[model samples]
Target chain A: MDNIAGTKSSLTWAVHISVAALVFLWLFPTLGLFVSSFRTADQIATGGWWKSMFPSQQNLTLRASPASEQKLEGSLYVIEGELFEEGIEVEISRWGASSQNISTYAAGEVGEFRSGETVTVQANGSYRIESETEISGSRGKRIFVTAITPPEFTFENYQNVLFDESNREGMAKAFFNTLTVTIPATVLPILIAAFAAYALAWMDFPGRSLLIAAVVALLVVPLQLALIPLLSLHNDITTFLNGLLGLEGANELKGKGYVGVWFAHIGFGLPLAIYLLRNYMVGLPRDIIENARVDGATDFQIFVKIILPLSFPALASFAIFQFLWTWNDLLVSLVFLIDSTGETTVMTKQIVELLGTRGGNWEILATSAFVSIAVPLLVFFAMQRYLVRGLLAGSVK
Target chain B: MHPAFLGLFTILVGVSVCVGYYYFSNQLLDKVLFPAKGPNAGRNINRREMIRPWLFLMPAIFALGLYLAYPVVKTLLLSLSERLPGGASQFVGFDNYTKLFADEKFWEALQNNMLWLLVVPAACTAFGLLIAQLTDRISWGSIAKSLIFMPMAISFVGAAVIWKLVYDARPIDQDQIGVLNALYLLFGGQEPQTWLTIPLANSFFLMLVLIWIQTGFAMVILSAALRGIPEETIEAAIVDGANPFQVFFKIKMPQIAGTIVVVWTTITIVVLKVFDIVFAMTNGQWQTQVLANYMYFQLFTAGDWGVGSASAMIIMLLVTPILVWNVYNARKEMR
Candidate 1:
């Protein structure tokens, strides 16, 4: 279509450039967080994440070996050692003795201290301090260097966010809790909706189209309306069941927990699930089901053996939608699952708390956010074809 | 119990129960209650057929009824009545609505929502159409499309954090970590502006986050609509000396107008119910309060269920037109 009539479109370059700009504009923010997740706090605070990809000039105040290790080398009491730790690749362009003038002398030049001791600092952060008299102070001499360090990144933020047990804000527990909420929330709706969708699509019952219309209406109903009523209902049910079982004082059953959340998700998810599956099943070849009916197979057996297998694509599509929706949901979990104890907090809630408590701590925020985002993103890129198909089928006529 | 173990256990139990119910109910309908071997086999088969659909539909109808249908009615009643002490309520009859109307924050939220409804859908559809057209003929278009689509997979909280970092501000003397501030300073701005703290413009900044996330959705849908346009029509227009812009505007735009409306209304619904971005980023402070977050604040933080239910009803009211339009379209298509 583009190269029709053997003449290329003159706007091709314009198209390419604009698309490139659009993609860049869209990817930049998420990419910023992704890059910042690997950066140390110092690196993130001192420069933009875009700058972290190249060598950056920094004003670092490092300390040399203390005078306690001073040795008498041929009439000079010398305190000699490296200013930076080993394996650090930094080149000092300038050095100084005081914080007031951090770049007074060039690297490898001698600068005299206020007490008349002379220090020679090299570009690689090794320094030699000498004096005719004994160096007496216990502390090391502070060496301020304007150094250029190569690009550096670390996995330590992820370690602290995900693996460190003593870190009170760690996401490990919340990660598992989210998985707990998401898996059942994703799987249960498919089974329930699949059976119902088959009935709606194929079964010739009265009020079938009306039921389909009702499902479509429920599709757009805001779940916000469900919060207060359903929450009170959950509480009432818990109280009633606790009393009925003689477990009132024990309080063995609470309103907010995994089972309650799973039910909520299943209820909220079913409309879309049934809508998508019914739409797909209606399009299934008519002859196959009719032939199976002629062969004396029951509708249940037909659905299980033939329709279920044939509707795999629609099933997979709806599964991905429900999985992503349940995984990335915050409101449902907050309302139905988390209690006052906060023991069952999911990753989204944890990250929101981190935002309030550690607002400026980009390292922790970025890492925790990415941890929550990584699963859906993996599923998205892997199963994007089915997702797009589902969207087209579900939304467009 | 460990959550992971409990999750696995729940899945096993839930799936088996559902499968068991479906299996046993069908068996009961076919064999026990209406056996084919019975003398009245014909009537028995008809009775079984009549009951089987309800058997399959029972769980879904139960869930949808309890979770969705009942809540609308319940929320409406709760909104209309004031709760008294000791688990009782009194009929207040529009008192909550009058109080909500008197509040400045409610009006502010309604105004901001109006602004969102106008801006988010327009921006998303325009950008989506632009990108869909731009990426239609390129070789690497799919990769570009997917990358643009990537943010849709991100949770609103994750997007809030991502955009929060993008809008971060620092003192003027220090290096700016946020790209927006960096660019602002580089362009000779005197001071770093806290972008999210600015009043009305800050709402736009928040809308930008949603726009960023949703444009991919519009693009995918519109791109499909664009592809569905007949090539012969485009070629015919080209042979008739329509320039690229002329061809697109005159020939193509008219064909996919319906899809553009579909994308617009869909995004409009999303923007109306947007909560997490405002909830996570600014928590509806500095006059950035939208309706959904405002309702959350009224309900949870203020513990005023009356006002909260009132606000929820307002949201449902705003969505009512789209709801009707969607159901109407579904019925029309069926006919």
Candidate 2:
């Protein structure tokens, strides 16, 4: 018992280290984005949020109240106001001639400027600028200032991303577009796949094996090969059908819309959907299917009654996979759906547009990114059990 | 002899039968299932068993041929020609292949794709194994798996957005707005490196996105494989005095080697087909392109269909051995 406890402790240590490493590996970049998104554009430029936790000095230049406004209380001109913001601490660093070279002053000492001038700024916003003659010009007096800022964060970036109507390519619209493309693409494949899978698995077949092999072969063919030809084929078929139906010159029917994309997806997706569904369907107990047949069931009846019901888990699993994949796909949509106007642009394209415009803004990117991912996250969580749950329910359950 | 004609004939017959059965199946199903239920359902019909197979095979057979077979032949033929503007293509045997071999961009794209195939699969497998192993023992195992699998749900396009923010670089004069540069500045770096613009490293950087997406897939499949390992075999090994590491390495790993290979190959095949991430993010610039993107560039943007087709065939040719192995393995597993 003692030995076992000791061994378990050591084993636990090994597991802990591995888990820690994996977590670090998985994290970091996104956390950086979350931290970055809150920062000012300048802050993100100069320092990381992690460093912002410490007090850091920054030079701020403000014009002193005009020389005319400098009150003469005694023999001197004294201006009094607060320096920096309230509750922020500052020791007056040396003042400067220009915003660029700001470290020329000592506390309680005057610095000479061009044209025989002098200025002094104290720990407070109090200051005095003296010249042999009155200072004049449209430009106001410039004072060098310093202040310590505490760590700050805001939802402002998210606000800009989500609420700005001018941003036509906002992630929200793109998210909807993605959903528009994804749900149909995902569901269509499963519908077709389930029907085809049932036919391939349970329905007797002569070239069944050959068809399966052909699909299996297709699983290898790269989708890139099909982009143009498939589009033209789609164009040809739609035109031919429309012509036959006397819906002449329906050119608008074929390019860059949900219809075109869904069909493209269905075309590209059919082979795999059938293949995966068939793999799962073939695993169904022969007895259950046989019993339904023996009970005088037609193929469609068995498919609807016993097979669809029995195949729920596989259907669910395949649905989860297909949904996630199609939801994430860009290439299929790009070739099949992209048009001159970009009316049907999806979330992926929208994000790329953002990358080009506000590419430097991590806050906007992260917020938009998180927004884009929300649905997929929901779908994955809702459907992940299908990946592992026993599909042979009661046949082997 | 041509599969296209074969497919066409099959489609015609199949469609006719499906339409014929639209009424006929009602008669058959009523007798068979309902004895008289709905318009589509009926009772008492005679059909031979021999006809059913052909009936089922028709749609599956013909659909596969036109979609898969004809396109494949057309693509191979494309490789042997030069795609002229206005869609006329002239014969130019091996020119595309030679161009691909000699072209720097082509070589770079191919190399990047190979890197993706190598790194994405192996890293995903490793990361997945770590997550699976860690989560398996913890009380919140399901939560961990679900969290890791979250990226699986997000489109690669979506995940790429998240990562792009991380890798985003601004001008050096501007504040480091991106997370990566911000961190780099924290430690004092001068150049605000556009991480994606960095040629060679960008491949690995891009690979991380694929890894992020694939880890969940790998984990999901492998976790299933892990659960499939019998407890009795494990306990027996433990009783025989195998340590936890030994049990894991010796017993568990060996049991799931087939699953590992299947998952690895599955991802590798998908990795070879990866175009979305590259196309969306970089548009094949700064050495971030892969074979699929190259094919897209040549065929669509460049309007060189023959070269595009040639590249497509090359990709298919590259994937053949892996696909064959996959079928063999899947067949073995089915048994």
Candidate 3:
């Protein structure tokens, strides 16, 4: 006993360290995107997200006020100004009058300029150029300064991605489109699966065992096979319905819309939903169901009153799975829901388009990607217990 | 209508339809088709009891048959035919399969998918088991586990963008914006590399995203299995002077071997069906193709339904064994 306890205690520090390392490894990529979304385009382009939190040293070229703004002060033609724009905070580490020697003079050190002029640059990006002769050139003398700028972050990326009406790549409509596809996709399947699961679990049927096996088998079927056939079928049905009803332009009634996606999601989600719900429903104690039945409550009443509440964990679990799957889905919505008009495009498709069109624009890509990721991440954290419980129920057994 | 309103209307219609179907169908079955309160009450009651289960099961069966089972057969048929313009198809009889096999890009996708299959599941399972074991006795285990598991929620496109930033590259003489290039340059590499444009390594880079997402899944399931191990087995091992490694390997590992297989197969299915990551990241360029994306390219981009359906069949072929295995296990469990 002593040896066992000693060994465990000795390994505790190792366990903590390894777990921390794993967590950091997993969280780093997402944290990078999250950080990148908050940063301006210049910051994202000039430095890695890991450097976004700290003051970073940068070499910037700033000019003094233009020659027009130059003034004569005390027997000198002088130009005095801060290198950074107003309200910007930076520490000038080094300064030079020429681009060839950006770091030639130390901060607060005086350096000789062209001819009889001398300039001193302060740490706070303030500088003065004085010469007995007047300053020339329409442009002020170009001053090269190496400065350390504090970390800056903004909500502008999110605004551009989510709200800017002119940005064709904005995720605002795509976000709503995804929600339209997802809610019914998630809810329709659960309601249908719950009723079916109750029958499979508690009610007696001739082929219950076979149905259970079929559900399990269907759980592993790759949905890739469903795409082409389903699309053709939907098209054929839509054309037929249009001709029969003489509703030519109104063919949009069923082929591509929220209802189409809802049905498709139900079709795809049913096997797993039924499998999960039945597994949960089967585990419920037989006595409660039997007592209710003996007291003359119908199966529907029993399902609504007894099993529904009792199976809340299972329902919640499957809801999260379906919700996440539907929310994150690309192929289903791409094939079934979205049309060429691009009005019904979901976030996944929107992000894929951004990846192609605005591939180098990390601000847009990161912000749009994060917007799509945000809802599922929220669902994940909030209903994580049920999600895990569902995984264990679905996979482990 | 506005999509949000349309969505709300769908919820209302879908819910009411489902509720009404079950209620009306059951009512019609019990009260109309075979009324339980009739002169033949006993027979009517027995008949209703028998019919009620099917009524409950009808919608799910219709959905499953139409959505899943029918598509399997339809896709198989489509795979063997040449789809022409204007909704007509000729029975080409395996021409698509031959053409697909002959295409080098299809072969590339197959090879990369093979590499993905061989790597992602093994790496995820190993890392998952490692994390599960390491975090088992720690105080912040759940917090650590949650953080690691958080990526599972993110869409593949989102993950691709996340990793795209990580793999973003700039030429030397400029500050490196991407983390990988930055680290490479910081450690003294000549010229920052374009990570995604490289062939074999790029697939691995993409595989890294899936592995990151799946490892947490493997850990959560395996961790639960590890906890489920009977205390007596470990106590007995400890009493017998077994080391911690011995207890874990000889005792705990064998007990959870079944679950490890389960996790492996589940992740394997995910790897087999992997599309969005490659689609969003590379779209099968630079030898980063997988079958799903290749099929998508064929169907949509290239507009070849026969070849596309054939590739879809190939994915179905890969999944069939798992489907059989799961059904077998389910049958055995039921028995």
* Candidates 1 onward: DockQ, in order: 0.80, 0.29, 0.83
lDDT of 1 by residue, B1-335 (tens): 79899999999999999999999999988888999875899999988899999999999999999999999999999999988889899989999999999999999999999999999999999999989988988999999999999999999999999999999999998999999999999999899999999999999999999999999999999999999999999989888877788888999999999898789888988988899999999999999999999999988899888999999999999999999998888999888
| DockQ score for model 2 | 0.29
- Candidate 1 matches the true fold with a TM-score of 0.97
Q: What is the per-residue lDDT of model 1 for residues A197-238, given as tens digits with 9 covering 90 to 100?
A: 999999999999999999999998999999999999999999
How far off is residue A23 in model 1, in Å?
1.8
Ranking by TM-score: 1, 3, 2
- CAPRI class assigned to model 2: acceptable
Clashes per candidate (backbone, < 3 Å): 0, 13, 0
lDDT tens digits by residue: candidate 2, B1-335 = 33234334544554465546433654554446544345533222333354544544455455556666667777787788886776677898898889878878888888888888879899999888878877777666776677676666666766677677677776777655467787787688877788988888888888888898778777867777788999889878876877777888999999988778877877888898888788767878987888988888988888777777878887888888986875665455444
How do all the candidates rank in terms of DockQ, highest first? 3, 1, 2
Error of 1 at A328 (Å): 1.3
Please compute and give the TM-score of the first chain of candidate 2 against the native first chain. 0.73
lDDT of each: 0.93, 0.69, 0.89
Write the residue-wise lDDT of candidate 3 on A1-397 in tens digits. Answer: 4457435567777878878877887888889999999999888888788887888888888888887887899899887888887787898888887877888999999987665578889999888888888777887777888889888899999888877879678589989899988898898899899999999999997998988888998898888888888887787888787778888564445677666778889999998899999999999999999999999999989999999999999999999999999999999999898888898999999999988998989999999999999999988999999999999998825
lDDT of 2 at B270: 80
